[model samples]
Each structure stands twice: as structure tokens, then as C-alpha cells.
Target: MPTKGMSPVSFSPSRASPSPSPSPSHHSPSSSPPTPRKTLSSSMIAENVDTAESIIRKWSVEDGSSSYCRLDSVFANDRTEAKDFLRSVKNIQSAMQFFVSEGTSSSSEQLVRAQKLMQMAMKRLQKEFHRILSSNRNNLDPESVSSRSSVSMSDFEDYEVASEEDDIQVTGNSVHEIVAGDSVSDLAMADLKAIADSMISSGYSKECMKIYKLVRKSILDENLYYLGVEKLSLSQIQKLDWDMVEGKIKSWLNAVKTAVKTLFLGERILCDVVFSTSPKISESCFAEIARDNAVTLFSFPEHVAKYKKLSPEKMFRLLDIYDSITDLWTEIESIFSFDSTSAVRSQAVNSLTKLGESVRAMLLDFETAIQKEGSKAPIQGGGVHPLTRYVMNYVGFLSDYSGTLSDILSDSPQNTRSPLPESYFSSPTCDDGSTSALSVRLAWLILVVLCKLDAKAEQYKDVALSYLFLANNLNYAVSKVRKSNLKLLLGEEWIENHEATLKQYTANYERMGWSKVLTSLPEENPTAEISPLEAREFFRRFNSGFEEAYKKQMSWVVPDARLRDEIKVSLAMKLVPAYTSFYNKYRGFFGREVGVVEPVVRYAPDDLGNYLSDLFYGTGAGSGSVSSSVSSSGRKVR
Candidate 1:
């Protein structure tokens, strides 16, 4: 028998002769004329014998037996050769009865041999067929042919055989060969091409490119299985030429783009299904898909912009999936480094940013609508259900993390150049001055939200007050530093010029009742009583005040002596009022009022000249002595 690697032989049998007729009855004398029918020709008999011999030889080698040599001993009579042949290869037969059978008998040893030989030949032919297939792979029909041919023989042979068994055959050809038609290849190529084309057209050219690279890597790296051979390991496979792989990838990308566009109907059904099912799937699976989609979508600026343009309803659905993914990521982050307060804080900040961005994108339409109609327009009820609750929970978590993070950072070396206050209200600084922009942004956003919520509005009042106090402190600190610098810049002559302006600003602030305006605001529903137009005007004024302050500082041309006197007087004025108020309100909290009120009143003496003289002489006088002197001098400054 031929081995697997051996070539197959073609068997072209000649036509057989007609069968002989039965003999006439003996009583028929006149039937002497009954002639003998033509029997199988000697050439045909020889052909049959040769076929049987070949079969016997093949089986003998295959089974490692010499049973074919005992044919004559088994079948003694030639006339019963066919019958004897059937009996020899029957269910049970002795060695002596095996060889007497003819090739055509069902039980014949020769018949058994012929069957075995035919099986071997068929296998060899199939091997040859596959060899031809592999050689002509470039021209083969992909649709009709099995791509499983690319799989290892051991891996897919059984499946291939099963498939072949079910397929109809043509004449003498096997199913596999018959199925390889032009139509099959055309269909398959069309499908592949369509996929490629759609990808390119849909602006997913990069993804298509990646697919091509993956295919080439799969093939060249031998990650791909091949028929007729054992599976190759990574090392066994041929290394891919990067240039060739690149070319293939490009081609595939182009094709994919075309195919994607052709099939894409802007139906977000698939996206919706995937996103909806993600929560039901394993977290890792969801993360992988989400990350992949994010990367793919964000890779193209146009796609990102397009995605941003999606209807609020659809965008919210996408954002829901993103939030789920972010939640999972947060969990993972916690698992890995939650013990490290800094790490936890960092992750929380990142998660918050991502969440914020997603929310902003989803609510963009709502924001636009609100902006256009003003907040009084009945909020289109369907924006984001449970969004506020979700945000609150996250904010609470963040607050806790922030506390921990602050503790950790407190232990680190201070950045003296831009130091934060020991107390929360010591000063306020612009967020851009901070190392942690996210932290500052989060703090501001939290404050804003708190201010917005009716229930939480009062809770945030103290926070707003704290911010304002800090801002005032910062201004005071900056002013103290700027005074010396300004004196140096303008020389002593301009001091008078600056002093007058400082006095004017103080008088204006007091007369305009700026502080009173702020203090009274909390008692009124500013939004309810104030029309939208008026509210807008208020915002404009609020912004303009800050802008004017900035412009004044930048353009100021103060005289040196007056600037020094102005700064000194302003500092004294600001501190005296604040300290006096503190003494009045909290003096009872102290064990002795003398200690608290005495220092405060000393600074605000009715005798300004006497207090200045005392201060100049570095003499700390009692408030009683200062008041008596002021009364005697009739110089009550207040």
C-alpha cells in the first residue's frame, strides 16, 4: 500500500464482456443447434486477475500478512472459484479455504484485499487532491473551498470528512473538488471586499489596517493552522516581512472601509445592543470591548465629533455604558492601589474627569436647550434620570478620598513658592497655580452643585463664605507684597497720588454698601424675584467688577509717598474692623474680655493722633487711656 506521502495511480478499466446463457434441456434432440454464449474474454479475465493480484499485494503489505499465497490450497476446484472466493472471505473461514475465492465474491479474501486496496488508493488520491489544492490555492474558490484547509490536518480532517460525506458528488469527482467553482470564489471575494470597502468608507480605515496586520501576523507567525501538516509553533513559522505585511494591511484596510460603509445604515442598533448587554457580561469583557470601541472611535477626530453630534437620547445610552466601564475601572484601581492614599486620589480624580466629560457630552443638548430658553423653561424632564444621585454618591466618595489625600500631601515638603494656607480660609489661589488641576476643578464643581441644590444650598453657604474670606486674605497678602514694589517703581513723589485713590475706593465701597448688598442676598430668592434679563445683567456686573479691578491694578500710576500711606492706612483699616467685630461677637468665649477687647479698641482709638504717637513710640497703651486722650483732644476720628 502507498504511504500518505506517496503519489496516486490512475485506474482506467476496459469494458467487460456480456454474460453467458443457460444450457438447453437434454430431451431436446433438435436443440443440438443451441450455441454457447460469449463468455468473458481472456483479456478481460487477465485484467480481472491482475486487478485482484494488485489488491492482494496491497493488502498483504498493509496488514503485514502473506495470506494471498494460500489461494490454491483454499479453493481446489476452479469451476466454483466465485463461490469459494465468497466463502473464503466470509465471517469465519480456515486458512486453507481463504485463497480459493475469485475477486468478485463478497466473502473472497481477494475481494477483502480489493476493498482495502481501494481504500488506500482513495486516500492517496485525496492526499494528491489536497496537494493540488495547496499548489493552486491562489486560484482556488474561497467560498466553495474550505478555509479550514488552512487548519492543520489533524485538527480538521474529521470535520472535513464529515462534510464531504454529506455533500453530493459528481461523476467521479470528490465533493471538495466539485465545490470549487467560480461562483464560490466570486461570492467569497465579494464578501471580503465588501467588508474592507465598508471599513474604509466608514472612516474605520485604521481598524481595517489593524485587521490586515492581525491576519498577516496570524499567517506568518504560524498562529494560523494549515492542512496536511502539524501545527507550527511561533518559532517554526516564517517571519513576516514588515513591508509586505504593511502593504497587505493597507489593502485590507481599504477593503474593510468600503465594506463597512456599504453595510452601515447609521443604525445604532448594534452599538445599543452591545452597550446594553455589557453590564450583563463579565466586567473584563465589557472593559475590553469598551476600550476597543473608545480607541477606535477616538482615533479619528471626525468620528469623535460625529459621536458628539448624536442625539441626546442615543448619546446618553453610550454614556451609560461608559460610566459602567469607568466604574469597573475605578474598582480595579481600588483593588490595586487603594491602600495608597495618593494613588486612590489620583484614580478618583481621573474617574471623575472621565465621568464629567461623558456627562457633559450627553447633556450637551440639554444644556443648549436650557441656555436658549433660560433655566425657567420647564426642564425637559427626560435628561438623565438618577444622574444627580449618581453624581452625589461619587462626590461623597471623592470628598472622603480628598481628605485622605490632603493628609498624605500635608506630610510632603511644602511648595513654598505657592504655599497653601494652614487653614482653609487663610487664602484663595487660582486653580491654575495648583499642581492638581483636577482636584481644584472637582472642588469648584462640587461647590457649584451644592450651591445649586435647594436642600444643600444652606450647607454650602459656609463654604462660599470660606471662599470669600480666603479671597480677601489673598488680596491682603498680595497687597502687602505689592506695596514695597510699587514704592520702588514710582519713587516717593507718586505716593500722594496712590493715597488719594485708596481713600476714594474705601469711601465708594462704604457708601455703595457693597458688603450690605452681599449680606442681604441670602435673605431673598434672587432667581425668583429677579427676571432672567436682570439676572443676566447681575452676572455681567459681577464679572465687570473683577475685570475693572484687574484693569485698575494694571494701569495704576500711583505717587510713592501716598501709595505707602494708603497701603498702611488700608491695612490698618481692614484689620481694625475685622478684629473689633471678632472681639464683640466672641469676647464671651474667652475667659477675660480685657485681653480680647483691649487689643482691638487700642487699634481703633478715638484719638487717632494719640494712638499714632503711641504706635510710633512702640508703647502699648490701655484702651481706656487712649479713649480719655481722644475725648480730651476732641479728636474722635470715627
Candidate 2:
């Protein structure tokens, strides 16, 4: 049962309990006047008013003024005093309603006095409410508030269970354990709720809501500013340099995670708990406090996407922002679930859409960059072309973001004309039987680079060097794909196919580069009967042809050490044994019978092997200096 002279709607701040609904009999103004009775306790009502007046006056700001002494601070020191204060205010209101309902003309003066006391009590509560909010700014910070678990309402009656122990537990340990536990924050929330419940129930919701929105909105805006979220227009973002834009984007990425996960989420929880009795006010307060900042936070990405300078280099940062939002989509939906905050949700989604569109544009722009590469000069030594390095490196990095790109590219339209043959995609490159748009898109970019490489190779005038250029560049592409996530995306079969193409290029280079040297050796068996003249002629031709081929190819470069070693070993296999057999058979015979001015055999078989080892070093040094590499057969080429 409620206290005799108090309204029945009391709640204990320490206990977690729902607001009690007032009984109509307890609070409603009687429609019919009560019958007059001789036993009516007029003195008893007077005594209740006198008791409430003393307590109300004890905490009044002045003798009679708008401001009132803060009550929660007093409550913090002595909780019983707080309970007496709330009960006293309720008693004053109860006494006022009693005289009005009984229609007692003689008690009008006592009723008026009760109303004045009640007004004074409410003013004290309003000041106390605002004071607690302002003083506990750090204690009620969003991160700490958001980390609290939901309060479980006790089964017992809240008013009956109000205890000093509960108050001590709530206020004494709240600051130290605000994040680790919920006592301090709960105490603060319960206090705010108690004041809001009283104020709203007494028809002062406008003032309560006004103070709440003003303080909380300021806190939210300050937190957002510290988080580095800015509201720059598209033109402003466009005018910023790339480094500045990137810095802002990185800051946003960091800020958004905390904002969505803690700040806005905490505010929502705080509002709902504080204004539990008035849900419309809670929702309105939350929307007013959080929606604009959230929209500002999300709208930044859209502004960045609207940046006029779209380049392939900027794609990763855009994707980073896209990935950040994509990661928090479910949380964003839940945090801003209220219909009032739908614009915040819409802005997040709009930013994602714009970022996706920008990434797609960058992909097309990158392809255009490949096609329009106008550098006509051939790369020295037919090494890897700059276009090949740039494209492969770009594609290699793209593979790291395959999962994000899959979502972004899922709805993108397919290219009508690909640089590669239709058969390339149909091959095992799309080994999963389903080709994702990202896989196809990345594969298309790579093929554009390959086609561009084909054009770059033609810039080389030497046929053999052109083949070497293709071999070197294609080897680089295959190596890049093999080492990165591109292998999973483009599959083993694609690597194998490209490796096979690389081998064919290597073969074409070998066949073209060595034609003169190989053809210089006659097909006749060296043991067959041959005159000294024929023998001399063979050695002379072989020396001249070998020298010319070695000089031409020694300056050529094969940058990949494994590929370089493989080519050298392969050439030694083909060239070494044949020359060794011919030189062994002819050297002694030419020296004995021909009496040539110089030795008829200008090179030992080992000398030829030594020179072949020096090919592809890009040194172009003569056979005077041979590398320490041995022949293919494990013999030192001395």
C-alpha cells in the first residue's frame, strides 16, 4: 500500500522496476462530491500539508524563487532524505486533490498552500535533474553507458523495497565500475528516469525533454567532432588533395566503427531507459540527438565518392570505406531501427551504393589507362614492360579484396568485348564452374594488360628479342598470379595454361635466337671422311656464327632468376654435347693436317659452354669474362 497522504505512483530509484500505473480510485477527481460527515479529519489533512511544507521548504532554492537547491546531491549523501523529499512532494499533491474532490470550501486555503509547496518541490527536482546530467558528463559517456547490460526488474514492489543499502550500492561504486559493472551507470540512469517520470507525470515533459535534448545533443556533437567526422560538401572534398582526402577517409574508417558500435548505440539505450514512461519522447529524443550525426557520418563517404578525380590508385581507399560500411550493415540497421532514424540508414546505404559505383568506374578507368598507354619506346633488353608491372601489380592487389569485390561486382554488367578470346574465360580460369563478375572483371583487366604487352613487344625491332619480351612479361604475370590470392581466383589450371604459353614463348625465342649458330654446324657425321679444307671451313663458319649470336644475346635480360637459370640450362643442353663431340673429333686432326695460321678450331667445347653461360646477363661482355656457372652436365665450363 502507498503512504497514507502520498499518491500511489511511487517508484524506488535503486530497484529496477517498471513505472507503476496509478489506480483510478487513488488519483482520479471524484465525479460526485463526498457526503458530509462529522468524523471528517480536517486536522489530519492540515497536519499532512504542514509536514510536506516543512520538507519542501528545507530544500527550496530561496524563500520562494524559480531556482531550487539540488536534491539528488543531497540524496547521494543520505538516501532517506531523498525518499522523504519525493514522498513529501507526492503528499502535497495528494492533499491538494483531496480538498478539491471533497468540494470543501473551508479547506481551499489549505489546498492552495499544498499546490504552492508541490510547485516548489517540482522546481527543486528540475534543477536537481539538470545538475546530475551536467555533473556526470564523463560518467554518462557513451562508451561506458553502452557497455552496461540491460537492467532486470525486481519481482518485489519497488516503493516497498527502497533501502539505504540499495542506494549506497548504486552510488558508491558506480564510478570505479562504470564499464566493468553497471552500478554507477544504473544509478545515474535510474535517477534520470525517476526525475523524468515525476516531471512527465506532473505535466512538465516539455521542460524535461528540452533539457535532455539540449545537453545530450551537445555531448553527441562534441563526441562526433572528436571522432574526426566532418560534413564537407562534395566540392570541398573534390578540392582537397589526395593525401588530405585519404587522411580524412582513414579517420572516418576509424571513427565509424566506434560511432556505430558504441556512441549512437549507447545514446539509444540511454534514451530508452531514461524516458521509459514516455516512449514517444524517448524515440524523439534519440532521433534528435543521434540521427543528424549518423547521417553526417555516413554522408561523408557519398561526398568522397562524388570526388571528380577517379583514378585506379584511389580504388583501394574507396573499397576500404565500402568494406567498413558493409561490415557494419547489420549493426547500423539495428541501431537506427526507429522509423525516425530511417534517413540515417538510407544515408549509409546510399554511401555504399555510391562507393560501389565509383569502384566500378575506377575499374573501367584502369582498363582505359591500359589501352591508352602511348609510350612507344621499347623496354631495354626486352625485360618486363612498365605496363605489365603496373597491371599485374594492380590486379594482384585486387585479388586481396576478392570477397568485397564479389559483392560490389555481383550486379555489374558484363563487358561486351573482352581483349582476350572468349575461350579464356570458358577455360579452367573460372574453375568453380561459376564465374563471378569480379573474377571475370579482374581476368579482363589482366588480358587487357596482356594485349597491351603484345603491342609493346612489337616495338622491339628484333624478332628474337620480341619473343624474349613476351616470354619475360608473361613469366612475370604468371609469377604474380601464382604468388597471390589470384591463384585461388584464377585457379591452378589458369596458371598451368599461362605457364604453358610462357614455355612456348621461351621456345620461340630459343629457336629464333639460335638459328644461325645451330645451322652453322653441318649435319655430316664428324667421323665421316672429310678433307682438311672442309674441316677448316666448318670451324671458320662455326666461330663466326657463334660469336655473332653470343654478342647479340649477351645484352638481353631475363630478370626472373629461376626463368633465367632455366633458359641457360636448356640452351647448354642443346648446344654443349654436339659442339663437344665435333670439337673433340676435329681439333687434333685440324692442328696436325691443315697447318692453318690460327688453330682451325678457334674454340674448345668448354670455351663455347663458358660463353653460353654468360648469355641473358645484359652485360654484353665478350667471352674474355665467363660466369662461374658450370655446364648442364655438372662439369665446370673452363
Point to the candidate with the largest lDDT. 2
List clashing residue pairs in candidate 2.
174-184
Candidate 1 lDDT by residue in tens digits, 491-567: 23334433344455434433332233223221243324444445434434433442332232222212233332343
Query: RMSD, model 2, all Cα superposed?
Result: 8.2
Error of 1 at 29 (Å): 27
Q: Which parts of model 2 have CA positions greater than 4 angstroms off? A: 1-50, 62-72, 90-114, 149-183, 415-433, 522-532, 592-597, 622-638
Angstrom error at residue 493, model 2: 1.3
- For each candidate, what TM-score against the reference? 0.21, 0.83
Q: Residue-wise lDDT of candidate 2 within 1-638, one digit each (tens)?
A: 11122122221122122322333343357465544552365666677788878878888754554244433354466665666777676666667667676554455656666666766677677777777677777878899777753443321113131322245333332211233234566667766777777677666677788778877888888888888888888889989998999999999989999999889988988887788777799999999999988998999999999888768999999989998998999989988999999999999999989998999889988999999999988998999998899899999999999888988887677543344454454333334455556767888888888888898888888888999999999999999998998887777777888889999999988889887777666675655667767777888887777778777887898888888878877776677677777777767775554555555666766666567766776885523223334433333211
Q: Tell me the whole-model lDDT of each prediction, alpha carbons only.
A: 0.30, 0.74
Badly placed stretches (over 4 Å) of model 1 are: 1-106, 136-181, 184-638
